[model samples]
Target chain A: MRVPILSLGEVLVASIQDALTDRGWRQLQADLLAQAGRRPPPGSRRKTAPRGVVIDLSTMDVMDSYATRSLDGIARMLALRGAETVVVGIQPGVAFAMAQLGLGLASAGTAVDLEAGLALLAEQVRGDGRHHGA
Target chain B: MAVTMAPESRLPVRDDGEIVGARRAARALAATLGFSETDLTMIATAVSEIARNMVEYGGGGEMTFAVIDGDGRVPGRRGLRITATDHGPGIPDVERAMQDGYTTGRGLGLGLPGARRLMDEFRVESAVGVGTTVSMTKWVV
Candidate 1:
């Protein structure tokens, strides 16, 4: 499934709502990175690119090692584009599996879910959670 | 030592699609055996890794699922047992391959070791140019 990238002012959101196949995940990575730091598409009123990215994985039930490493890589690449990436909504079961597997999102900011993830990104940018919503 | 009493269900795993199928089959089978939610996730995840390894490096293979039962003989050893066999080039050093962070492909090298950690019983048999077979059992507590 091709995930739609939504914008929340300066933050971009990619909510994965389906069970991902390999081809599906590769496409998602490409789509997110392609828009990470690029300027707003032509004919838009926004003057700035996304300052942060929120990847919501609440709907994801299973997260294997390959997907874990891919997300870690995406986080680092997003940093290179000047966008801080927060991975949120990791399912309890998936989190347990990842821990047992020794997989981690070492370089990215992690939170319980979308709300917490955005707050984390906000704090990183201005040291205040309220700043991003302003 | 546990005894498996049910007939085994076998599936041919040739690609990513089959990998998904194999794991889903695992979940369904485990649920029927009354495995807890957490255990179901663990079993499915382990099945995925081993199935992926079969496709990525082992040149595709066959996966089998068997339901183990105590039958009043083994007590709480009832659970799900899985075995994956592949015809692709096998591992040269099974010990090193079983270590965490060891990989011969583009993966994180967590396939074998990570799957091993999730299951209760795990073993691997391989010959460099011959093939590889992995067997794992996740017993319900």
Candidate 2:
């Protein structure tokens, strides 16, 4: 199934609510890149360029090597396309598991929650001198 | 030396979807054994890694889960054992494969070693032209 990707001004938010297959993850990567390339929604005067992408994984209880690797790849791919990526809402159990597995998402910004993720993204955009529509 | 095997269930690992299924099943079994939330996640993660390896590198395999009850020394102790086996080309170098950051696939090379770290007991047996089998166990404290 496709994970929902929501656009908030200059950022794209994807909340992964389930453990995704490799195909599902590839779809998400494609969708995120495609969404990043699209123009800002109508009625918003923000720049057409996407400044950041936030991936929320609060509901994900398991993140194996494959998922971790895919996230890392997606973050790097988005970066190459001029969009910063933030992974947020990693559950404590998942964190412990990842740490034990020696898996790390080093390429993406991370936050403890959605609000913090959005704030981090906004801060990044502002620091880069980009305009995030109100 | 001699351990009695409890009832077990086998799951096929054919694709990424099956990997997720295996993880869910493992988590459910672990929950029945009263594993904590953290332990549940850890066990599930280890299951995912081994199952994914089976599907990816091993060309598909079967995963079995069983409950092992302690005997004389440690009475009333219970643990879950997961075994994954594949009749595909096995690892040529088990030593290198167990090292962190060694991967033949498009992964981060954490599957084998990482799964080993998550479980309390880990064992691997593989032959180059034959197949590979990984067994891991997590106990309830």
Candidate 3:
């Protein structure tokens, strides 16, 4: 399915606890990738793929190597969907640790203020103006 | 009031379940001192990574969780102690293991150093064949 690039409205998030399970997230990512390849229903108003994902990692304070890599994995999966992910509300220490582990904001995608992230998603939907084939 | 600590809890590193158990224990200890949800998640993620490292690299081992009250010297802090030990071949070089993206397998070598970043204190002791013990503590004041 060719991921649409203009239909994004509200962000979608998979189950956090579920994704954290052993290789469970990997499977989800795969499913998302497959879904990304499809087009919206006939006569849909939106034009682009859904604005990727907004991981509400606000509940996180401590992170280990696995979580860092898992995040990267999630980011990579989203990219396959032709949508970018924006991580918001991350604490300084957590952000620092992620950078130390090489999971920096830039490596995965744009790390922006919450407002900016929403705006970027809206902008992507508005600017594309073309319905990408599914 | 004198309180006793939980004796080490150990489980084979067979799956993420083991990691969850260890993180739950760590979170419970953190809760006793009023840790925020963000803090709890951080500790959980860190512990989960270490536990995964034990299973993947160490060929499986066990994890331990304990609690500690930071000494006055540290000022305004209490802690939850988590230790994951493995009998499998110990890390050849602790320093190298701490580096990011340093992995021998399809893994990101963020386990050790990532945990250190999440906690207020981190210590590691390992010997080739002897074993490895990683002790970490997250503070909650």
For residues A58-90, write the lDDT of model 2, one tens digit per residue: 999999988998999999999989899999999
At residue A48, give the lDDT of candidate 2: 72
Off by over 4 Å in 3: A1-19, A41-63, A88-102, A107-119, A129-134, B1-12, B36-39, B69-78, B139-141
Candidate 2 ranges with C-alpha deviation above 4 Å: A41-44, A130-134, B1-4
lDDT of 1 by residue, A23-111 (tens): 77788878888887789878888877887999999987788987788788888888888788899999888899989998889978889
Ranking by TM-score: 2, 1, 3
Better of 1 and 3 by DockQ: 1
What is candidate 3's CAPRI-style docking category based on DockQ?
Answer: acceptable
Badly placed stretches (over 4 Å) of model 1 are A41-43, A128-134, B1-4, B71-73
lDDT per residue as tens, model 3, A63-92: 556665666777777776776666655666
| Candidate 2 lDDT over residue span B35-86, tens digit each | 9999999999999999988988999999999998884468668899999999
**Candidate 3 chain B — worst ten consecutive residues by lDDT sum?**
B1-10
lDDT of 3 at A68: 59
Q: What TM-score against the true chain A does chain A of each candidate get? A: 0.87, 0.91, 0.61
Give the clashing pairs for model 1: none
